[model samples]
Target: MKGRLFLIPVTLGSPDYRYVIPEKVLEIIISLRKFIVEDIRSARRFLRMIDPRFPIDESEFMILNKHTDYKDLDGMMSFLKEGSDTGLMSEAGIPGVADPGSDLVLQAHENGFRVIPLIGPSSIYLALMSSGLNGQNFAFNGYLPIKRADRIREIKNLQTMARRGQSQIFMETPYRNMKLLEDIAATLDNNIYLCIAANITHPDEYITTRTVSDWLKKGFPDIDKKPAIFIIGIKS
Candidate 1:
């Protein structure tokens, strides 16, 4: 019999895992001894934070990141043939969404393994729910181009999509959050609504939806070095 794969969701930023992570999920995490994580150090830290008694030394961790090649995936699923249940964890939030774990999950499915997704905080969905924009139709664009010309074009494309009643969602590296914000403010129409959600689930969490014109008038917030999600759409 093939072992099952559990999709684990780590806390967004709050130090207390209990607040964002469910007890049922924690129970399943406690039962697993093997894991495929995006980052080894953060995965270990999260496990220890969830339960101090968690057997960090006894558990095995396989790294899956941008550099992981197709050949490496076979080894990631090796424990499943032995009927050992394995967990998949991302650096933060749920695995498989804007996460590298999606490739592993696809491999598991191909090998006839059961994939179970546990409930947890997703910054994208969280931002969408709070944005007061069109939830029925939305597109997660992942990331815009880093180059100024290309980024402006991408912004225009997203705005065009939004004009058609589809909400556009995207994210950027923490260090580049301010630059992206500037681009959005300058490139988008003044009447378009933009939501900036920063440090989601953390004490410093900030989420607001306002017109681009209003945002320009008030100036951008201090979102430097903080994880954030940006949504562009017309207010409903």
Candidate 2:
């Protein structure tokens, strides 16, 4: 029998895995000795966090990132074909969503392999759920451009979409979070609602939704080096 491909979900940043990852998922992760991972060190650290005695040295890890060649994917499935269940893990959150594991999952489906996705914390969904915005009609716009003019234009485009009854969800590199926030406050209308959810699932987590003008009055919070989700809603 061909082994299944388990799509594992790791904690966002919480030290206690149980708080974000399920017990069943932990057990599944422990049982799998072969994995296709985004970052080997991070993946090993996550396994050890789940179980201190996890045989890190004995486990096999295959790297799957933007740099990985598509030709390597076929070889990645060889272990599964030999009846060794393989795991797909991300640096954080679930694999295949805003992560590099999507290609592997699509290849698994094409090869008729069973794919199992485990539940865990997702900053995007968590932000959307917490933000009193239009959840029924929302879009996840992964990240905005880095260029000042381009980024501002994209933010305006998203604002237009939000006005049409859709919520816009986006993110930024931790170091550039404040820059993105500044562009948002500068470009967006005062009445358009914006939500900033930072350090989700971790201590010092902050989530708030306010109009652009209100946010300007309060000034940007110190989320410079924290993982965060930015959401824009048509109506508060």
Candidate 3:
């Protein structure tokens, strides 16, 4: 019988897993000696953070990321077929949902492996629930285009959907967060509300929702190099 695939979740940035990670999830992570991970170093660090004495040497890890070849997935799946329960983890947050582990989960399903998803912090949902935006109807647009012009165009398109009562959520690279905020303030109407949730789950976490005009007057936060979520919607 094939072993199960556990979809694991890790903390956003806080080293203290007690804050965001549940006890059950931590135990599951500790039990799994073999893992299919996005970043081996980070995965190992997380394991050790949860339990100082975690055996780093005995564990086996298979890399799964943009650079990972598709052919390597079948090899990674071997652990399950051989009755070794495996855990799939991301650098932060839970597996899947804008994560590379989605591919591995899909493969597991197709091969008839039992996949169990553990509960934990998700930057996307965490931001949305805090933002007083339209929760019943919303979309996660992942990352916006890098080019200024193209990103502005996409922002406008998202606003169109937002106008119909659907909220638009997107992100930008940490270094370019300020630039994205600028475009959002410049292109969006004053009444359009923007939610900026930065450094989520960290001690310095900041989450706020304000009108474009109000945000312009107050000046954007110093979040240039911080991971963040940008949500656009209209209160009315």
For model 3, residues 45-101, the per-residue Cα lDDT tens digits are 888989999999999998998788777889999899999999999988989889888
Whose lDDT is greatest here?
1
The reply for model 3, stretches above 4 Å from the true place, is none
Q: In order, how many clashes per candidate?
A: 0, 0, 0
Structure candidate 1, residue pairs in collision? none
Cα RMSD for predicted model 2: 1.0
lDDT accuracy of residue 132 in candidate 2: 95
Candidate 3, residue 70: Cα displacement in angstroms equals: 2.4
Error of 1 at 54 (Å): 0.8
Error of 3 at 30 (Å): 0.7
Superposition error at 188 for model 2 (Å):
0.3
Considering summed lDDT, which 10 consecutive residues are worst modelled in model 2? 227-236
Global lDDT of model 2: 0.92
**Model 1 agreement with the true structure over 182-230: per-residue lDDT tens digits:** 8887889999999999998999899999999999889889999999999
- Using TM-score, give the best candidate's number: 1
User: lDDT score of model 3?
Assistant: 0.92
What is the lDDT of every predicted structure here? 0.93, 0.92, 0.92
Model 1: number of backbone collisions? 0
